[model samples]
Target chain A: MSLDQQPIVSRNPSPAAPPAPGADAVLVARDLSVWYGSTQALRGVSIAIPRNRITALIGPSGCGKSTLLRCFNRMNDLIPGFRMEGQLGFDGDPVAGPEVDPVTLRRRVGMVFQKPNPFPKTVYHNVAWGARINGYTGDLDELVERSLRRAALWDEVKDKLNRSGLDLSGGQQQRLCIARTLAVEPEVILMDEPCSALDPISTARVEDLMEDLKAEYTIVIVTHNMQQARRVSDMTACLMLDEARGNGHRPGVLAEFSPTDVLFTTPKDPRTEAYITGRIG
Target chain B: MSRASDALYRPRRGLRRALGAGFAGLCLAATLSGVVVLVVLLGAVLVKALALPPNPPWFAVGEQLRELAAFLSRIASSTNSPNPELAGFKAGIIGSLWLLLLVALIAIPVGVGAGLYLEEYAPAGRLRRAIQTNIANLAGVPSIVYGILGLVVFSRAFGFQALALGKMLWAGALTLSLLVLPIVVIATQEALRAVPPSLRQAALALGATRWQVIRDHVLPSALPGILTGTILALSRAIGETAPLLMVGAANSILFPPSGPSDYYTALPVEIYNFATLPREEFRSVAAGGILILLGILLSMNAVAIFLRTPTGQRAASRAIAQLGRLGWSGRRAGRSRTGLASAVVVPGPGASGPDSEVAQPTDQGGAES
Candidate 1:
């Protein structure tokens, strides 16, 4: 039970390890580390997110899964005193570069937060706002309809398009958020525990929607639920807390990255095996 | 033994009830004391004003209203006169109304803008913190101090000497505006701060520029609160006398102010002049002026409360909703006109048809697993 008696497990893989040869990665993070003030959250974590697939980051609480997901779209930049070391690139261009405007970057890389956050506007406006701000001059009605249908929420909300987005049910609101993100036509969509706030039925619907959405846009999801990772993700990256390192509260680092089946059935790292088996988190 | 112990532990209900009743009585007395003083003061003023009666029913509400209307008309039409009975507040009313208009025109926009910048866009550092603290302190500063400041700044420093704006209506208006600006800014800032952070985050995440987010989301939600605060600030400015006095508001004028640069006297100033004179008739006139001032302030407050109500908000949203529908319909008509060209240009990316390509991978992944 003592702290020193715990095993010093090295979850970090060699830097020379290349991504799967034929995989088309839309995002490539190299030695990514994040710190909030002096407290580190992610430590040299690296992963190549494949295109047209759901890459789910699964781990326990305080495992930097959400932090790593936010790093893809640079959401962490919103936080004060947030420092990032290492490179995150989208389509071979550095995300944190001075030339890369976060506004434009975010447009191309949309995000869905953990909670369902819809602007206090109508459903139609919620979807249209993103496109409008991005200077989309096309038929907004058509676009909003298309996005809602793609999110599997068109039938429920088409009649009440003028109704406030906040008036919808929680599940509908989340789908509205998804539709809003889709309206902008982002190349990649990042979701941070998108279904954590929903009921089982809503979560299942979102999972089904995600499965359908993977063809045109890449998705990177952070989930605390192990079954969700197994059910929806094509590839699973398990991150774990490295308590023995740094000032007793060291940041989380990736323990295993493999196909979902491989990670579930035969994890390369013992820590990942322990986590997936529910022995220790 | 249990019963004995229970009796020992139980509270003295009678004594406790007595103490509660005593405290309640004290609070009731405290509230009534204020009401009592107000009623006594108003009664005395009314008795003095109505010293002479014309009919049998001297205190009828309708009769009093008629008399008040006649008295106000006399005051409105009469010019300044040496006779105490004929002296009126026509110049005061006009000056006050003009001052109110100018103060609102200048203060609301400036104060609200400062509030928005401070609350939304200002960098959270020492400079912003210092400015915030200074604004809060300024709101608490004495009105007379602001008067002196206005006298030096707007009246003397900036006012062209030949134009004589230093002792004009505009100068008094400027002083009152400055006196209330800090209050308006502080209230507006509080209102803006009450807006949910999630709304901002949602807008920003949708790729909105900061200004767009504020204009499109934040401002609409904070509108009611902002209006209420501005109204309250304006009301305070309307009733202010000390600042105007310091800025040299005239005690008497022959005619109403013709322009911003003309000499002016306000309701409070007129009342002060009349009340200070050694004449009973002038004191009654001053009481009448006080009644009118109270009516104006009360009406302004009522308007503020009404606007802050849910019904007012619903009306506003309804108007916005109508506009939205109009725009939507107009766009629909335009699309119909350009149907062929639009069809070719639309469906650029992430459209439903292209989704078929994305759907395949998900199907394959499910099959493979």
Candidate 2:
């Protein structure tokens, strides 16, 4: 199929808010909105996914947390009748347009979906895949070892590098997913509730892994787990629904965005407080 | 107790439930008729094969059986040498083997590759949808039509004269391969789909390219399943008759197809040829041939069943499950080359390092559609 790719070469190089830099702000989402046919899911959402830090988006069910996160990498484009209006840029390149290829965009902004999706391959092959595709030429074992180790899966999976990745435990599979993502060496990594499906032990382990991951690459995660948000993320964006059903049909909107500590301890919106305090979903 | 069991325990107060159970039992009994017929046929054939003749000769019922036994006896008992000869079934056996090889060569790769492309790489759109529907339709197209296509295309158009140099053999192989292509594609696609999409995403996320992820993870994981399905398809191709007729299979050929250009007689074709005969003895030979065909099919299936190569993940899962609650040291102790069996969930690495980890799949690499 013909994939659309157009370079927005002449984009205004200025941002509305400058994220204090340590690592570059690799991906910037400006007023992104999404629709599934006539049904709107996200409405006028803006967020800066900074590099080398884990930014967790937390909200209740039907709050458009996952939808806004998907916009950053344009994975929303995959679903038929799934449309988005607004701009998402990767490293100053516009990603939220038909002209921008999702495949190419995904290569740079690697993603780990909610489920641990280890390919039906050997553990070694799974980690080595991204490097191979991008024309990597070096010691493969070293690369595999490095990625797996980073994912905390290398020590466990080293012996059976030739074995299929599916044979791993749930936690291991999620880590394998993480390792697989690392293989591509994407600047921005999107984890869409990576630990939501795992057991408590696995969730804790994945949280630990996320903490380690933020030291290297920018991470954006969408989760319903408030505890996980507090544990793994440096910055947190809380989303909530407005009483729009009474006014007219409208999608969920972001209630507040701030540093993780500040947002959890003292949220700007009463809706955010209501959610964190278990008063309202 | 299970909710279903509890529901059943709840007294059936209505006639409708009783009627429903009766209908279910009726459906099952009806289905068993087909199953019983198959079992009975199998039992009859096996019994006939095992029951040796009680007469003095005590020979098999195949056409060349009595004569070959005589010839062997003469050579052994009389100390007289005999010219090296092959029984009729020998030619049939060789023809069948070569045809299977050719079909496997042609049908499997194209079918599985197409399956992979359709399931993995293809975008959901009009063209891909059309191709998928076309493949489904092709699977349902009459086998006789494939035979006709083979005849017109290979024999008539390409001028394939015989099976000696492998002409009829190639034609028949191509026709049979076409007949089974849709099956393989469908089987492979299903097998691939059964595999979790996370595996693909995991590989892709790991800095693996799309091809790399598919090659390293997706293809290998789906290998055993795809192979099993393809072998099933091969069995279907082996027994085909109408397609052979289309591709110029010999009526009563005495010799095996020596090359790609020779006239060949396959098992079904040989059986078909014998069954159409005027003599009662020839019909027995055909029945004997039917036994032989069953034997071949069973053995092939058995071999396929026996030759299951476990995927890395399967082995790992098994090993890991066995080592339940084991720590790193215990995991290490149980681990061999079998797989990396552990429950550790590590964070992924930053993008940097050598890219050589992704190796290409060995067997199906260039062997293509």
Candidate 3:
């Protein structure tokens, strides 16, 4: 039950990248590992996501960066038979325990997906769905307007709130999605490649939104873009997958995790160094 | 991203364009035939409707037209027919309205509820597949078959032995419910499927219970669709004489049906009775009755089509947007001028309840807004 005394994973690199001193612990994912049938996507990864800050999970394709973020509030529970060993805790409670209901936890941890999956509805209706589901019975006009405002998209989309979410350009739709999440008031926000579908300027807008939002919610982002990690993350966890001959398995691993400035400047691990230098992923 | 580069490996541009034109032409030709068929059928209905007449504009059923139009002037000016079958038509119109009410009440809830259960809760596997296939098969079954079943189960056993809502309106309502239940359920499921899973997830992420989310968000978005399907099905039920026959729909009911076992005869049954009469005068009466019947059928269909229209669906979404605004109570009370201004001032925390920690500041400067 004690997280600190749990067996140290031998394959894990040195503790040079442990949560920095004095940082607020929001989501403490300790000894987290995920398996989908015979294939293990994540192996014994531990990282501390700080409160009111962005912790970017950067990695190449097939790594379990996104998987770790899903564990924060057990979004993985939606996927059948997705088992995780070791305790990933929130505050001090188990993230995936029976006592931690997925519905309530999900409310505390909202997510914006890679593709902007807006409901096939008008912009006003799309923003309103979050509050309505929570049995909110108050002034709806104000709630809808406030959510759009927080996402910094109300001005652009305000006049056309009645228009379909689909009519907006791809960038606008993504911002709409962010507005929808803001409406929910999640304690933590998990973003899985939130800007991958956007152009560079759109990507910058989202990154700016991320910066603005982190003051109120813990943000954990999983992205393929390296420059994005340097730009937005306070802590960067670079993940990679290499052949594991001992088990004849090819599983994604966390190569190194360090503060964003340090990781991009001077990563301790060679694989981390190679990944940042664009030599090997 | 040059056009030439994008087209480099594609068939030579001119040839590709020619092939594209040919394909478009083929589709156009096929579509044209469909349009022609629709026009011809519509033309036939109008032409036949015009042939029956003794009044102004020959084909017009004066009093029936008054009822169809529901115009104050027409209702006052139109003369009533001395013909009894034509007289009984007033009763049929009333009956059809009552039937529409019954169908909507009994079928909509059952069908939509079943659909939500099947789509949102059921796992994708054998049992789900079987239920899906069963529903498909049920939808495909003829309305006449449901009529026969209604006669046996509703008229004989349940209505008689149980004495629950006897040969009354409920019996016909029951039969029609079974007849259209599959269609409503199927539409509801498709509507639910059409809603992005992200919406469901987003709601759950905001401390919403499953039922709450379903009642407020999912149901509102899906309402127009469910009603559209149920209305379409009810319109189908209105035209059904075969099923009502097995359940003992009377041929000469001078009065309108008030309840379950009143021997209800819908518009179709009324038309059928007139068409079978030996008198030549009765045939024109049937034609007039047919026009009335078409009017009722068309009205129900028009309502269904209206519900399915994009504008109608958006209208149904008003309740949901209202609920979303409720989650932010105070700032919305003050004007923000723009939807974006109001949204930014809306509180983020305590989204679960109203008056829960609104994030708004200074109620002052928004005055200009």
Better model by lDDT, 2 or 3?
Answer: 3
| lDDT per residue (tens digit) for residues A1-281 in model 1 | 12122211122234322354356667777788899988899988877777788988998899899888877777787788889998777876778857778888888889998999998776777997899878887866678888999999999976566567888999999999999999999999999999999999999999999999999899989998899999999888999997656577769898888888888998888999999999997
Q: CAPRI verdict on model 1?
A: acceptable
Estimate candidate 1's RMSD in Å: 9.4
Sorted by TM-score, highest first, which candidate order results? 1, 3, 2
DockQ for every model comes to: 0.30, 0.31, 0.33
lDDT of 3: 0.72
TM-score of chain B of 1: 0.82
What's model 1's lDDT at A274?
93
Across B40-68, the per-residue lDDT of candidate 2 in tens digits comes to 99666444333333333344457445643
lDDT by residue (A136-157, candidate 3, tens digit) is 6665567888888888898897
Candidate 2 scores an fnat of: 0.36
lDDT tens string, model 3, B1-369?
577677656657898899999999999999999999977865554444333343345355675455334432231222224463334365555566677788888888898889999987888789999999999999999878988888778777744576544456677778888988999899999888777676666556556677876875688777887777777887887877787777766676667777645656666676787668776555545555566666677887888788788877766565555555455434444543444444444433432222212223114324323
**lDDT, candidate 3, at B325:** 46
- Candidate 3 TM-score, true structure as reference: 0.76
lDDT of 1 at B171: 86
User: lDDT by residue for model 1 over B1-369, one digit each (tens)?
Assistant: 367668667688999999999999999999999999989987777665554345436558898767767776776677666686788888888888999999999999999999999988888899999999999999999999999898888778755676446788888988898888998898889888888887877777777788878877888778778888899999999899999998888978888998888888888888888889996778777777777787788899997898789887655555554554454444444442232223333234543331121122223333444
Highest DockQ: give the candidate number.
3
- Cα miss at B188, model 3 (Å)? 0.4
